[model samples]
Each structure stands twice: as C-alpha cells, then as structure tokens.
Target chain A: MLRDALLIAGKDLRLELRSRVALNQVLPFALLVLVLFAFALDPDRGLLARATPGLYWVAVLFSALLALQRSLSVESADGNRDALRLSGLDPAGIFLGKVLAVATQLAVLEVLLGVGVAVLYTTRITGWVLLAVTCVVATASIAAAGTLFGVVAAGLRVRETLLPLLLLPVLAPVLIGATRAFEAALAGSPSEGWPWVGLMGVFASLYIVAGVFGFGPLLEES
Target chain B: MTTEAHRQDIDSTGSNGTRVLGIAALIAMAALALFGLVLSPADANQGEVVRILYVHVPSATVAYIGCFLTTIGSAVYLWRRSRWWELVAYASAEIATVFTSIVLVTGMIWGRPTWGVYWVWDARLTSTAMLLLLLLGYLAVRRLPADHEVRTRRAAIVGLLLVPNVIIVRQSVQWWRTLHQKPTLLANGVGAKIEGLMLFSLFVGFIAIGLVFAWLLIHRFRLAWLEDQLDEAGLDVAIAERRAEGAAS
Candidate 1:
C-alpha cells in the first residue's frame, strides 16, 4: 500500500511539475490575495501585521481549493479516472497518494506564503518550531479533507461550483486551528500554540483515516 | 395481484401511523406553547426572551437527531448498498438542514436580547453555523445531477463526514474562543435556575419537536421512495414507447 501510494504520489507530483499550473497560477493567486489583504486592511496602520496569520491561512485555504480542483481535474480529463481504476492499484493508495501530492504542493505554497507575509506584511515569526508544526499538520488536514471531497465531486458536471461548497465548510476547523496557532507563534508564545497544533493533528489524522476508508467506495462511484 | 400490490406501495406517502404521529405532534406543540408562553413564569434575568428557548433548544435537539440519523443511514447504505438507507440519509439530511437553519435563526434571536447582538463569535454559535454549512454541502451534493447509484454514493460519503467535521469544528471553535478569553454569554443564559413550569415546558418542547421530526422523516422517506419508483417507471415507459415506434416504422 505504501509503495503504491508512493508510485501514485510520484506520478501526480511529476504531472504537476510538468504542468506548472500550481507554480504559475495558484502561487500567484495566493500572493495576490496577500497583497489584496494589505490593500483592504491598510498595511501602514499595523493592521496587516496583526491580521497576518489569519490572512495568510485564508489565502492558503483559497489556494488549496484551486490546488484540489487542479488535482481532481487531472483525473477527469482523457479518461484518466477510468485508466487509474483499471490499473488495479489499491483505492486507498490512490487516496493517500493524492493527499501526499496535494500536501507537498501546499507545503511549498506555505513556504512562499510565509515569505510573502514576512516581506509584504512585515510579520516576524517568533516561534519557528511551533510555526513549522502548525503548517505541516494543518496542511495535511486540508489536503486529506480536500482530496476526499475532491474525489466525491470529481466527475460531476457541477464539480467546479460544488467542490468549494463541499470542501470549505469541512475545513473550518483547520482554518481556525491553523490561524490560532499561527497567531500564537507570531506573538512569541509557543505554549498557547502547541495545543492548537494538537487539535490540528487530531483533525488531520481523523480525515486521513476517513479518506482511507471512504475513498474506495467514493472512487468507484465517481 | 402483483400490479395491485405495486400500486398500493406507491399510492401515498402516508399511513395511519404517520397520521397518528402528526396529530400527536400538533397536540404536543399546542401544549408546548401554552406551557412555554402563557403558564411559565418570566425569568428574573431574561424575562420574555427566555421563551425562545422552548423552540431554540428543541430545534437544536431535533437537528442533532437528524444528523445522527443521516450518519447511521449513510454508513448503513455504504455498507449494504441499500436504497432504503440512502433515502433515509437524504431525507434526514434535508430535514437536518431545515432544523439547523431554525436553530441558527432562533439562536440569533435569543442572542439579540441577551447578548445585545444578533451574532457573536461564541463557540456554540460558530460551530452551529458551520454545521448548517456542512449540512448544506450534503444537500448540495444530493442535488447534483448524476446516476442514482453515483449520487447516492456521493451523498453518503458527505453525510458520513459530518460527524467528524462537527466534532473538530466544535473543539477548534471552543479553543479559539477560550484562547481569546472572550466571555461566553450563553453559559449564563442557559445555565440559570429553571423552576417547575419552565422545565416542564422544555420537556414538552422536546416531545413536540421529536414527534414533528418523526412525521417529517416518514413522509420525506416515502416521497423519496416514490421519486425512485417514478424514475424507474418513467424509464420503462420510455423504453416501451421507443420499441412501439420502431415496430410501427
């Protein structure tokens, strides 16, 4: 199962690297959101600095939607879904693979966004360890939940409109937890942030397990 | 005889049992109103605003029940691939969405007089809002155009995800509220001392709402069953018509 997952993850990441969609489009869109936040909140008044954590995660969440859409859209085209199903790889492996691929993309996006926030919002991260843990856990949570719903919404004609509607509400906890943890880390208080990381860890594991068990049936149906 | 039996199956989405349940719900609702509004004494703190609890709390309870039913129905449907369980999940989800909406509106109404705002970032309120959104997501998936098996499978997955989502949302929101050190105004309003009639009113509210929920569930499930039957019957008719046309040509 792990080998199959690695094989599928490697294929998706390679496809993404070739396509450059995430690097070209999603990355820019995320940075634009950060800039837009600065404009809306007025960067000069210290509001951007105060609101950086939330705005950063909000940007990431929106971009994650795009990434998830992109991830699933890959399967939708050219009968890839049918091909993948016929290949006899374990469905659970496909699920974990897609999650890993999306998480890897999101991790890179977060690094850039961290830089974007630092450069644009003049935000300084005081708790580097706390910040790193939150990003990894929260990204896994988002990717797992997103990949799960992405498959659920995959082949439908209304998938474009339906994916966000289905995915965003389920990711509410990740948003709140990640934002709170980011706030704690930025405020130089790692103690308060650790618990939120724990919460995100719980969310991440729950959805990962859910995705594993739920994916086979969903993949067949979609 | 088989055709007659089939006709009887699809005839109506009601029965004597549902009629009894409907009448019982009506009586219970009436009693709830009397006990809640007219008989129950005014509270020292909230006074008239406390009456909304009779509706709000009961609606929230019914909504949670609906969520539980959906979860069970979805899980069973996935396990057994039973259309009956799929319909149950779908019906319960729609009903849950309605009650969750009611809970939100009534909660806001109660919040206005008690918290001096129509909305607050309190954990319960935030979590309930998210629950409403999650239920909406489930309904949206159910509405999407797909083959029956495909749509049912999609809806079941979304329904099954609700429990975990609700738990995480509640926990995260609670921690978010607490970390900010914001006072939970709802704690005071609901935790206040309840005397004889108020407690009785609340109890009556529960029975009334639970009965209403049962009534709705039965009718909605039957309606969904009828829909499935109609779709199949329509397909059969279409196939026959096409064959007749081919024969005539």
Candidate 2:
C-alpha cells in the first residue's frame, strides 16, 4: 500500500514537473493577490504591518483553493479519476497523491506569500524555527482538507460553486490556527501561539487519517 | 408466489405518503405556535425581542433534528441498499438548511438589540453558519445530475462523513475563546433563565417542527419516486423506438 501510494505521488509530482502548472500559475497568482492587497491598503507602515499577517494568509489560502480547484478538475475533466479508480489503485493512494501535490503547490505559494508580506509590510520575525514549523502544519491541514473536500465537490455537477461552501467551514479551524500562529510569529510572541500551532498539527493529522480512510468508498461512489 | 408480495410493496409505498405525517405536522405547529406566542413569559432583560426565541430556538432545534435524521437516513441507505432512505436523507437536508437559515437570521435580529451589534464572531452563531453550509453542500450533492444509484451512494457517503464534522462546529467556540453565548441547554445542567412555561413551549415547538419535517420527508420522497417512474417511462419509450426502427429496417 505504501509503495503504491508513493508511486501515485511520484506520478502526480512528475505531471506537475513536466507541466510546471503550479510554478507558472500559483506563485504568480499569490503575487497578484499580494499586489491587490497593496493596492487596497494605504502604504502607512504601521497599518501595513498590522494587516500583513492576515493578508498573507488570505493570499495563500485563496491561491491554494485555486490550485486545489485545478488539481481535482484535472483528474475529472479527462476521465482520469474514473480511470484511476478502475485501474485498481487504492482510493487512499489517489487521495495521498492528490494531497501531496496540493501541499507542495500550496507550500510554494506560501513561500511567495511570506516573502511578499515580509517585504511589503516589513514584518519582524522572532523564531524562524517556529515560523517554519507552523507553516508546514498549516500546509498539511489545508492540503488534507482541500483534497478530501475537493473529491466530494468534484463529484457534484456545480463543483466550482459547491467547493468553497463545503470546504470553508471544515477549513475554519485550520484557518484560525494558522492566523494565530502567523500573528504570533510576526509579533515575536512565542508563548501565546504555541497552543494554536499544536492544534494545527492535530487538525492536519486528523484530516490526513480521515481522508485516507474515508476516500476509498467515497471515490468509488463518486 | 413472491410476485404478489412484490406488488404489495409497490402499492403501499406508492400511495400511503403525506396523509398521516402532514396532518400531524399541521396540528403540532398550530398548537406549538399558540403556546409559544401566548403562554411563554417575556424575558426579564429583553421584552419583545424575547419573542424571537419562539422562532429562533425552534428553527435551531429543527435544523439539528434534520441533520440527525440525515445521518440516520444515510446509515440506513448504505446498510440496506434502500433508495427510499436516500430520498429521506435528501428531503430532510433541504428542510434542515431552510430552518438553519431562519435560526441564524433570527439570532442576528435578537443579537442586534442585546449585543449592540448586528453580528459578532460568537461561537454559537459561527457554528450554526458552518452547519448551514455543510447542510447546503449535502443538499447540492443530491441535486447533481448523475446515475441515480451512484448519486444516492455518493450523497450517502457525504452525509455519513458529515456526522463527525458537526462535533467540531459545536465545540469550536469552547475550543477557542469567542463572543458567542455558550449552549443554553445541556444534558447535565439546566438553563437558569428557562421557566416551566418556556420549557414546555420549547418542547412543543420541537415536536411541531419535527412533525413538519416528517411530513416534508414523506412528501418529498413521493416526488422523488414519481421522478424515478417518469425516468423509467422515458427509458421504456426509447427502447421501444429503437426496436421499431430495427423492425422497419
């Protein structure tokens, strides 16, 4: 099962490598979001610093949502999703592959978002390690949630309309945690945000396990 | 021998819907509305705004009931391979979403006077919104055009998965500090403000909306079955046309 999962993941990664879809579109989209934020807000340093964390997270989340929309759409548009299911590939393996691809895509966008926020707003960072750790936790949570919901949404006729409604509620916990962690990291306040970071870890782990277990029959039905 | 048994199954299921549940629902709602509006005393703090509770609380109760029924329907559908259970699930979900929206709106109206804001990021309100969205998603899945069996199975799976997510939405306020009021009622404790008459009214309201939901379920299921019959008829026509063309050729 692990071998199959890895092969599936590898295949998805190779697809992205060849297409460079994530690199070409996601990073640019994130940058454009940041630019739009800059345009919306006054350039006052204090105000920019105050709003930077939220702006950064929203940019990343929206960009990730976009990429996730594409990831699932790709599988379904070409009938690859049905093909994958019929190929005797484990549904869990498909979920894992898709999640990994989404996580990798989001992580890249998060980096660009972080750089843009830092440069635009001049955010002060206290603990680099904590920042890095929380980013990974947030990424995993978003990926797991997006993949699980993306599959369900993809099966619907009005998938694009239904995706956000299905995902945003489930994604709230992660969003809250990520915001707090990001805010703390920006403020150099370590103690207050640690719990939220821990919670994000829990959310990520639960989603991954649940998605893998639940994806099997869900995909079959879809 | 089994042909007669099959015929009976079809006949009963086809006709005996809505008559019983619908009347019961109407009676229950009329009794509950009168009791809630006329009998329940005004709150000490808020006077007329307190009346909104009759609408808000009942709506919330019905939504929860709807979600619970959906979960049960999903389980039954998956376990028994019964399309009837799927229809029940789909019908209940639509009713649930409607009630949830009513609850959220009434809560906001009540909050504006009491909290001095139209809305706040309170736990109770936020969770209810999340619940509404989940229910909407469930209902949307049911409406998607696909193979009937596949649609039913997929929706049942989504409905099954939804049961656990509600727990998160319920606890989100407690898990994080928020402005929303804590649950007014729970298993271990009684609400301080709840009077005997108010409690009774609430109970009546619950039963009333519940009956209405039950009635809606039966009626909607009948409609879904009618749709199935129409589809079958269409297929029969198509098959007949194909055979006629072949014969002519």
Candidate 3:
C-alpha cells in the first residue's frame, strides 16, 4: 500500500512538474496577494505585525484552494477519475497521493509568502523552529481536509463553485485554530499556543482517515 | 407487497394524507400564533421581547426536528439503499435550513432590544450559524447534480458525518460562556423560569410548529421526488425518439 501510494504521488507530482500550472498559477496569485496587502497597508510596520498572521493564512488558504481545485479537477474533467479507479490501485492510495501533493504545494507557497511578508513588512521571524512546526501542522490539516473535500466535491458536475462553499464551512475549525497557532508562534507568545497546534494534528488525522475510508466509494459514485 | 408495488401504493396514498396534515397544521399554527402572541401575558422582567420566545423557541425545536429527521433519513438510505429515505432526508434538510435561519434572525431581533446589540460572537449564534452552513453544504452537494444513486449516497455520508455538528450547536452554551441566553424551557426534563400559561403556551407552540414542519417536509419531498420522476420520463422520451429515428432510417 505504501509503495502504491508513492507511485500515485509520483505520478501526480510528475504531471504537475510537466504542466507547471499548479506552481505557475498559484505562485503568481500568492505573490500578487502579498504585494497587494503590502501596498494596501502602505508600509506600516505596526499594521503588518497585527495583520501578518491573517494575511499569511489568507494567502495560504486561497492559494491552497486554487491548487486543490486544479489538482482534483483535471482527473474529473478529462473523465480520467474512473480510469484511475480501475487502474488496479487502491482509492486510499489515490487520496494519500493527492493529499501529499497538495501539502507539498502549500508548503512551498508558505515559505515564499513568509519570506515576502518578512521582507516587505519589516517583521521579524522570531522562534523560527516553532514557526516552522506550526506551519507544517496547519498545512497538513488544511491540505488533508481540502483534498478530502475536493475529491468529494469533484464528483459533482458543478464542482467549481460548490467545492469552496462546502469546503470552507467544514474547514472553518481548522482555519480558526491554525490562524491562532500561527499568530502565536510568529509573535513568540508562549508554549501556551501549542493547544491550537494539537487541535490541528487532531483535525489532520480525522480528515486523513475520513478520506481513506470514503474516497473509494466516492470515486465509484463519480 | 413487493417493493415496487409497495412504493407505488405509498406514493398514491401519501398526497391525501399530506393534504389532511396541511389543513390540520394550518389550524394548529393559527391557534398557537394567536395564543402565544395575543393571549399570553407579558413577563414581569423581560417585557415585550419575552414574547419573541414564542417564535424563537418553536423555530429552534423545529430545526432540531429537521436535523433529527435528516440524520435518520440519511442512515436509512445508506443502510437500505432505498431512494425513499434520500428524498425524505433532502426534504427535511431544506426545511431545517429555513427554520434555523429564522431562529438566528429572531434571536438577533430579540437580542437587539434586550441585549442592546444586533449581533455578538456568542457561542449560541456562532454554533447555530455553523449548523446552518453545514445544512447548506449538504443541500448544495445534493443540488449540484441530480443523480439519485450517486448524489444520495454521498449525501448520506455527509449527513452521517455531520451529526457531531448538531451536538456542538446544542451544547455551545454549556461549553462556552455565550452572551446569548440559555434554554428557558426544558433543558433537562424540566422547565426553568417559566410555567403556568407561558409554559403551556410554549409547549403548544412547539407542537404546532413541529406539525407545520412535518407538513412542509412531506410537501417538499413529494415535489422533489416528482421532479426526479419527470426528469426520468424526459430521458425515456428522448431515448425512444432516437431509437425511432434510427429505425425509420
């Protein structure tokens, strides 16, 4: 199962590497959003401190949404989803592969956005280790949930609109916790902020298990 | 009776039953509305805003009923693979969304006058909004494509997964320090701070609104099922026409 999952993950990453659409589309959008935030605030350092966490997550979330929609949508639009299901691979493997790809794409976006925010806003990245840990925890949760929901929503014909609406609501808790944890870590608040990180870990596991269990039947339905 | 024949018989018998229910619900609603609005005395402390409880409590109860029905309907459909349960679940979810919306609005209206604000990030309000969103998501999933077998199956999964949301919504007050008031009547097999005619009026209002919700659910379910049937019929006609054209050629 692990080997099969890696193969599927490799296939997705290779396709993305060939097309370059996910990185090309998502990076520009993330960078533009970051620059827009910078200009909108007009180089205020204090405002940046307050807005940095929110701005960063918003960039990550919207960019992840863009990447996620593109990732699952290709199989759906080309009618290759059925073929994937019949390829003698486990559906859970497909879900795991897609989620890993989403997580990787989001991780790259986060690093870039973090650097942009630190440069443009004159903000310090205190507690680098904690910041990195929080990012991974939050990113894992968001990507897992997003991939799970993206697959579910992709089964429908009107997925482009419905996916975000359905995905956002279910993901609200993760967003709430992740944003808080990220903010706390960046501010160097304290170890007290770890609860929200714990919450993200729980959410990530729940979504991963749900995706593993549900994705097979869901693909058949599609 | 066999499954197909049984379903046909049920479908035929359901309309007359629904009409009788409609009339009965209408009368109950009218009577309760008058009693709760006109006949019930004002509370000594809360004044006219206390009257908002008439609508608010009933709407909350009906929303609960709607959510409960969705849970049951979703489960039955998933277990039995029967379309009837799916129709019922979809119908109940639609009605629940409207009532939950009303509950939020009425609560806000009552809040503005009593709490001196139109909105707060209170636990009750937030959780109720979450419940409303979940319901919308469920309905949207069902609506995006009208495939019964596939749609119903996915909807059932979503519905099952969403059960925890209902619990959280109900417990938001106990779990968090919410600005909104707690349940005034029957939190735990008993009423608090309300009794006599007010309590009776509230109970009657619950029953009346519940009946009205049932009436709406039945009507909406039949309409949705009919729409599916019509779509199927249209497909049949299109297929037959194509076969005829081929044969003529």
Best candidate per TM-score, number?
Answer: 1
Give per-candidate clash totals: 0, 2, 0
Candidate 1: list runs displaced more than 4 Å: B1-11
TM-score of chain A of 1: 0.98
- For B1-249, candidate 2 gives per-residue lDDT tens digits of 695975565564334456766777788888887887887887676765766776677778778888888988997887887777877888888888888998889888888887678776756677788888888778777677877766677677678767667765565445564422444322112234576887888788778877776676666666777677768877999999999999999
DockQ of each: 0.81, 0.50, 0.38
Models sorted by TM-score, best on top: 1, 2, 3
Alpha-carbon TM-score of each model against the true structure: 0.97, 0.86, 0.85
Q: How close is candidate 1 to the true structure, as a TM-score?
A: 0.97
Structure candidate 3, residue pairs in collision: none
Per-residue lDDT of B88-151 in model 1, one digit per residue for the tens? 9999999998899999999889888888999988888999999999999999888778888888
Query: Which interface RMSD does candidate 3 score?
Result: 3.1
Question: How would you encode candidate 1's per-residue C-alpha lDDT over A1-222 as one tens digit per residue?
Answer: 888899999999999889899999999999999989978987788888888889999999999999999999999999999898889999999999999999999999999989988888777668999999999999999999999999888988899999999988888888888888888888888898888889889989988998889988877764
Candidate 3: docking tier:
acceptable
Q: Which CAPRI tier for candidate 1?
A: high
Q: Select the stronger candidate by TM-score from 1 and 3.
A: 1
* Every candidate's CA RMSD: 1.4, 4.0, 4.4
1 against 2, candidate with superior lDDT: 1
| Most lDDT-accurate candidate | 1
